[model samples]
Every structure is written in C-alpha cells, then in structure tokens.
Target chain A: MHDERMISFMFDTNLTKHLAELSKINFTDDEIAVISNEMSEIISLMDTVTEYNIDETFASADPVQFSDLRKDEIKDSFPREEILKNAKGKSDTCFKVPKVV
Target chain B: MNDLLKCTVKELSNKLNKKQISAVELTDAYLKRINEVDGKVNSYITVCNEQARISAEKAQKIIDAGSANALTGIPMSIKDNICTKDIRTTCASKMLEDFNPIYNATVINRLNDNNIVMLGKTNMDEFAMGGSSQTSFFGGVKNPYNTECVTGGSSGGSAASVAANLCAASLGSDTGGSVRQPAAFCGVTGLKPTYGAVSRYGLIAFASSLDQIGPVARSAEDCGIILSAIAGRDENDGTIKNIDKADYCSKIGMSMKGIRIGIPKEFFGDGIDSEVRQAVMNAAKEYEKMGCILEEVTMPSLKYAVASYYLISSAEAASNLSRFDGIKYGYRSENGNTYEEIIKNTRHEGFGAEVKRRIMLGNYALSSGYYDAYYNKAVKIRGKIKAEYDEIFKTCDCILTPTAPSVAYKIGALENDPVKMYSADICTVTVNIAGLPAISTPCGYSSNNMPIGMSIVGNSLREATIIAVADAFEKQFETKEASI
Candidate 1:
C-alpha cells in the first residue's frame, strides 16, 4: 500500500522534511505515504477557501476582546513543589533538560 | 430505590434536599451501575470509587447542615481532558498516561464549590481530536443505546455515561461538536456554550479559540443547571467574557410563542441521512404547532465551513501541542541520547496515528510558504462565516439543524477513511467556528432504534433562549431513553 514515489511527488521534499523535523514525530515509510496522501487531500479541500471572495477590510473574528487589564498585583502562585509534581526530570527546584553543550 | 441512578439531576437534587436519599447512597448506586455496565460501554477510563464516596459523605454533611445547592450531592463525571487536582487527567493519550495535575480546572472548582460528587474521569478522544471516541487511548466508548455503534466523539464517553445512567450529568469540552455529537449519538442532552461562557483554565488545549467546556445531561434543563454553576468570568482565563452569569434554568419553562427559528437549507442538503432530515424537519413542524415561527435561511458560506474549521483548528493545534516535549510532564522516550532525538522519539511513541496526522497537517499548513494560502485564507473565511451567523440572528432567535448527519455509526465503519470521519462533523463545526451556543437534544429515534439529535443554535450568549426552546421541545416530544 505504500507509495514512496507518489508521496515524494505530491509534497515538496524540503517542505516535508522541515515539517517532519518541526513536529519531531517519526513516521515509517508506509505511514509517510499515508500521511502524504491524506495531507494532499486535506490541502485540496482547504483550497476551497480561496474561491470565496473575502473582503480585504474584514478582520478575523475575535470571540472575546480583552479591555480592562487586571491590576498587576502579586497574587497567589502555585507552590514550587506542586508545580514540579509532573516534571519528568527535576533538580533543585528547576526542570532538568538534556545537556545542550 | 435501585433505580435511583435513572433519575435526572433535578429529581435527584429534590430527593437529596428532601432527605429522602443520602448523597452517599446515590453515589453508591451509580458506582454499582458503573461496575456492572461499564465493562460493555467503556464509558469511564478511571472510576474514582473511594474518592467519590468520600465526596458524597462531605456532600451529605453539607445537606444535613442545610446549605445544599441544586447540584450538591450529585454524582457527576468529568471528561479526562479537564484537569482535576491529584487525579490523572490523561486526555485519553499515552503521552499523559501517568500525568496528574496539581490544580483543578475552573469548572472542577465550581463543581466542588457546589458540593457535587466527582465520579471519576470519563474517556474521550485523545486530546479531544477525533469525531469518534474511537481514537481514544483507553479504547473506544460504546454507545449506550447500541454497544456495537459508536458514541459520537471526542466526548463520547461523557455522553455515553450520561445516557447509560452511569452518572447524573457529566462535563465535556466541545472543540468542534465533541459534546453535542456524542450527545446526539447516545440519546442524551449536551450543550456547547457560547465561546467565552465557560472558562478554559485547565482543559488540555486542543484548539484554544474553539474549546469551550459545557455540560452533558439527560435534559436541557439539567444542562442549564450545570452551566449556571460553571459559566462566569475567570481572571485566569482572559478569553472569558466579563459578564454576569444568566439564570439558565429559570428560562427553561418559558413560552415558545412567536420565537423565530431559522432553518438553513444547506444544513439539510446532500449527505444528510434521510432519517435524520425527516426527524429534524418533524421537529421544525412541532415548533410550528407550538406557535413558533420557522423560516428558511440561506448561509452560502456553509460549504466552506468544514474546510475553514479544519485548517484553523489544525493550525492552532500545531502551535498548542508543541509544548509536549520529552523534558516536560508526559511520556518520555528512553531510546534517545540527544534532546531532539528524545523529543522526536517520545512524540513518535506517544501520539496515535490520527493525532500525528493532524499535527503534521497543522505544521504543513503553517509552514513558511503555505501559511498565506491555507491558514490566512481559512481565517478570512471564518470571519465571513461568523459575520453571516450574526446577520442571520437579527431575524431569528435560534437556528435549528440536525445535530449530526446520521445516527451513531457502527464501530470501524468510517475508521479507515479520515475524510468520511471529518465529513461527519459538517453540521456541528460551523457553530464552533462562529463561537455560538448550541444544544443537542434527542428529537426522535431512527428505525433501527438509534437516537437522532436536533441542534438548536443561538447567537453568542443566548444560552437562555436555546435552553428554553430545547426544554420546551423535550417536554413536548419526550424522546425515548437509551434503555441500556
């Protein structure tokens, strides 16, 4: 069912590579083919949006507009212990990530 | 009574208030039902039996002290995506399988303040992503009405639990019809409140702009009761509207005389099952008999709504889900030595196929060259759709449509086809895109005995009118229960 050639032809190679890297999710060759085909179908569906003549002056819908800003008073914050409860790796009240250097 | 679990929230509340039934007893009945039936329905991912019993005992004390609210002592379920302090909120994904939040969602706090008993977390589509609960990591939730059929999704477990009498009511988030679709399929009542009505403080972010937590219950009036407790401004959630909460339950019994309902012709067009169309049209006629005015309205932008919704939601999802790296609080991969490798390996191992596909599509749309063509255009169309809905509301108080294109489909029916599954959301997604309030109530049952839901959509913040109309219709029709 996998069509590597078709997937390579459907999407721009560099764009696909960049997307794969950005998402940071590995896909097998077959999964890549399936994703590419599905993505092509979705993009074609999305192309219908271009056919509608949207007024240039119309702003996108903002469901709620923030007007009054709350006073920037120091409020109660989550306890550090609670905040770090779900951390995968922590050291001395700080999140420990893989060494960059 | 052994059948106490079958009572509506309102009925149970009355009984609790009258001291006829203790909250502990009510919770015990529901727990027993869950233990007996949930194996077949798979509505709950984690049953908090001991915790619920403890909460019930507290609720009983509150009732004895004569400080009970309408929801006090009621056993209700929360969707897995909504964070509950110290309770595992997985979003039905392996990524968050071991994650437990230190804080509760704003709605959970509200429920707690009202003395509602928590009946543990219900199952849902992972990250509230799929239309069918089939995408859940905990396994697909079966429709209470027919175990073989799907419970319409993302909130499938929420609706199924309510319909099957597993709980008095449940809370489910609707990004694009996650609540209402499942409610329709499961023969229950569900509401997707107007955007900004319910604060989204701790809901696992799927699409921030589209996500609104609402109630799922057996009746529209019950939904209103739950909404009144949870709907309000939250300083934590800046998107919440700064307005006083309306008395939603109070408006339920109001007269429907002269209320104008707009029926969009496009909603009834091709691909709608004949049974669903007939049922909704019959509901429209029922409204006419009740002295409500019905008019056919044109919404030319309906054709582009699904396309626009998918693009916008996926784009937002791509950005929102970027935080789930291996370093944070979720499933981490041991196979990778480098940071990038760890993140990639973790994501690959953690996310399911549908979720990964959406993420890829989202990243693809927002990619450097394709942003203007896809994301920008979709946003513009969304604006137009919202404007059109606003214009239509000037003449009509509410719009009526079928909640879903058809009744609950058989499991694995559309599982292989993503486009077909996407198309299943056609009737409901537009409401989310426009940020309106909509309710799904059981209008009738299909020939196969599956429920058909009719959606009543109101303009933003018009939940009172929507609930009033739904309650009236529910009273008049009295649709059959799921009979699990």
Candidate 2:
C-alpha cells in the first residue's frame, strides 16, 4: 500500500556522511530522496497500530525451540563424474580454486 | 455437492467413511466446480489434474481394502508461497515464475503422507507482501463472497478456493494476517497455529520468525485436521520445540464452560466497522451463553505493533529475499556486463514494485548506520509485545477480536493507496508479531452481502482452544449460506 504515510525527513547529511565513512557505500542525491520517501511511508503505516496497556505477565515475542537437525556426520560424496559435471572450472575430481592473492 | 461443500470436516469425514460418496467422484465434483467458476475468480496458479487423478485412484484402492487416512483423497489447494516438489511453486512473483521446487514444504509433505489430493497452487501477493492480493504477479483474486470486492491478501487465493468450493480445504501462511484476514473476507475458517506448532521447512521464508503455515478451510474442524497432519518437530526448523502434538478435532465442539475468554479493548476502538463490531460482540454473547467467562484485557504494545512489525518483518524480508539474485536460479538477465550488473539488473526486472519497495525499506532499516535505530529497537519492542500477551493469557484462556476492521473493500479501493491497504491488516499483525496462535471464522455479513470474521487468539500451543471457541460460534451460524 502507499507507504503508510509521509513524514518530514530532515535532510541531515550527518547520517549520510557517517554511513559513507562506516560502510563506504555511496548514496546519491536520488537515493536519499527515495529513502526519505520510504521512511515517511513507514511512519504513516506505523500510525495505525494499537499500543494499549498490557499486563506484566506477557512477553512480546518468545523464541520457541525445535530440535536441531544439524548433524556432525560425514555426508555422502558425489562420484568423480557427477562432481566434475557440475564444476564450472575443475581439475581432475576437484573444483578449480580462484586466486584471491 | 454444494450442500456437501457446506459441511464441517467431521460431517464430511463421517459421510465419506460410510461410503456415501467415492473419492474419485468427490474429486471430479470439485474439479468440475473449479472449471466452472475459476476463470473469473483466478484463485489457482496451477491446476494439478494429473497428480490429483493419480492420487484419487490410489485412495480408491485403499478404500476397497477398508482402510483410509484422515485426509484420504481430499482435494486441497496450496498457497503459491509454499514449495511443492515437482510442482511449479511460484510465490506469485515473476522472479520465480519459472522456478520449480526440488523439495516439498513440511506441510506439503504431510498432506502427501495423509493421502490428500493435491489440487493446485493458488495465487498470492508477490512474495506475500501486500494486503489486497492485487500485487500478485499472476493476477488478483476476487472475494468469493462478493466478486467485486477483494479476497484479503497473500492467502487470498487459498481462502477464495475454499469459499468457492474448489477445494475442501487449503493451506496458507501468515506473516501478518495473510491467512486470517483473507479467511475473514472470504467467509471461511482459518487458523494461524501457535509459533512452532507447524513446521516451516521448505516454506519460502518471509520474515522467518513471523511466518507460519496453517489451514484455511470451510470449518474450524477442517483447520484442526490439517493442522494436526502438518505440525510437530521436524528435522528442518529449529525454532519449533516443546509443542504437545494432539488431534485438534478431539478437543473441538466441547462445551466452553471454564474457558476464560479475553476481549482485547484496543481491537474494539475507532475505525472498526459497526457491523463487524456488532458481529464479534454477538459471537461473544454466544460464548457467554455457553458459560464461558468474558473479560476485557488491555495490550498497550498493540499500538506500536504495526510500526515495530513492519520494521522487523521488512528487515527480515530484504535479507530472506536476497536469494533471488539470478545467479542461483530463476530468471537471469542476458545483458549485464559484470556479476554485479547481472544481480542488480535481474532483480530490478524480476520483482514487482511492491516487493522492491519493501526490500529497499528493509535493507535501509538494517543498513550499517540505521540498524540499531530501526531493526534492533523493533526487536526490543517485540519482546515487550510478547510480555503483554503472556500476562493476558494468565487471566484468560483466549482473546477475541474482529479479524479485520471491516469487510472486503472494492478491488481497486486500496490498490493505489498502499498505506491504506497495509493499515487494513492492523487487527491481525500483532498476533504474528507476538508469535501467537489465532483464527478467523465467519461471524456475520455486512449490508452488501460481504463477509465479516471474528478472531480468537490463545496462548502459544493452544490451537485447540481457539478452534473450540470458533466451533461454538460456528454452531450459531452453521447453516447460514453465502449471500452471494
């Protein structure tokens, strides 16, 4: 839906400048406008929810646990031909390694 | 067959056991109904005639042996969001329009094990984001109750399929009222089982913590049957644990005496349609008549639920959806210079506008500088929302409210006004955010013959309690026909 509603976004370059320094990700003037527009929509959507008084017993959201199926067992390996067939680059039964250095 | 479509699961199961109808005959009847009405309604994304026929044949063999599974030969539609191995499981997004899942979701696997006939995959908001079902990459789903109005979002197709009698039941996912809201709008019964009560393995994640797969059908009893088959500890999802598995039908239709029902005051506030309010109060009156104690409970965090929920859910959405970068699977852009170009170009074209907007907003919220301010704070607020529910449950066994603020709106009414449409989910989102079990059942009709739904939420792991209260209400309107 229309981003909930528009909020007045302060054009503070402090956040822009800080993000630039922190992540080195670039944000153009157009990108800022889009972000501002989106944040405003979020503000509008957030307005419709109810936050009435609740008793002290309830927790907001609880993390329910399921038994972990992750195992430490060894997996069955693909045969030479099968593994080689899937490799984009390979050398004898092994996937080729790209040099990072 | 039209009369049969109106019966509850217990009624239908009893008749089937008595050999009053054959599985093949029932499947053919529903298939016929689907062919006749589905062209205009657009509920299904794919119709699995070949597979359903094969399964129906097998069910006939089992019946001859005098043995049958709980869901033996029953036709059911799946919301496109859940992955079904070998079936084209499109999440109603063009990105995966050609994608075929390699494995079935836990729920899909359960349905297969129970010998249920797989009718087809139904439509949804592209990747389950919008409230109107208008954002579905395939097309919009119409409310079976009123063709002019929308079947509420994400799970709209599943709800409509059952409402139109194309399927005896269907499975849907709820991140924020996707199942319950549509069930309300389409005049059916839907249950969003307690967090971890149902396995989510292979269900395409949309805010993994909030998303749940549940049943959308004609009766709460049907929802119970489907929920029982699909729930329990799975080797896949680790978030679900300590849940006591039981047959929900066994607990349903029981007297509500000693069942403490709480009516959340916030849900009855301004903007709720007078008719829907009257309908819910009427259901509450029925509860009181059944000797259930009704009390008004307060949940203050509900006020910020929409805000916190959007921030966190979208933040999760952006990360969960990043998997469709073209390189792995799905549509790949032919003309991109580098790997980056391929990823960006493919995504820019594959996803619809609504999906892109949510992704960008989510990515922005969780980005380096704003992570704590938005995503992190939202998580903390979530903790508080859970605390509130825990407190209320001690005083009441269940909480009741109108599923949506109003009945289905005209198809285009909220299409362009995205915020207005998102606000339509206000009553239902808090349950998802708080990770509680909730259900929506038809309460009454609006003046225009549109359907209204009443929701009953219970403590986590209390799906049976919700269904019992819902069944009690269903008894009052058991024979009411769709005004359409």
Residue-wise C-alpha lDDT for candidate 2, range B448-478, written one tens digit per residue: 8888899999887888888888888887785
Candidate 1 — which residues are off by over 4 angstroms?
A1-9, A12-14
CA lDDT, every model vs. true structure: 0.89, 0.79
Candidate 2 residue spans exceeding 4 A from truth: A1-8, A11-39, A44-61, A64-71, A75-101, B478-480
Question: What TM-scores do the predictions have?
Answer: 0.97, 0.89
In model 1, the Cα lDDT at residue A30 comes to 69
* Leading candidate by TM-score: 1
**Cα lDDT tens digits for candidate 1, B1-484:** 2778888899999999999999999999999999999999999999999999999999999999999999999999999999999999999999999899999999999999999999989998899998889999989999988999999899999999998999999999999999999999999999999998998999999999899999999899999999999998888888888878668987777778999999999999988999999999999999999999999998888888887888889989988999899675998888778888888888989998888878888887787766776788888888888888988999999999999999999999988788778878899999999889999999999999999999999998899999999999998787676767
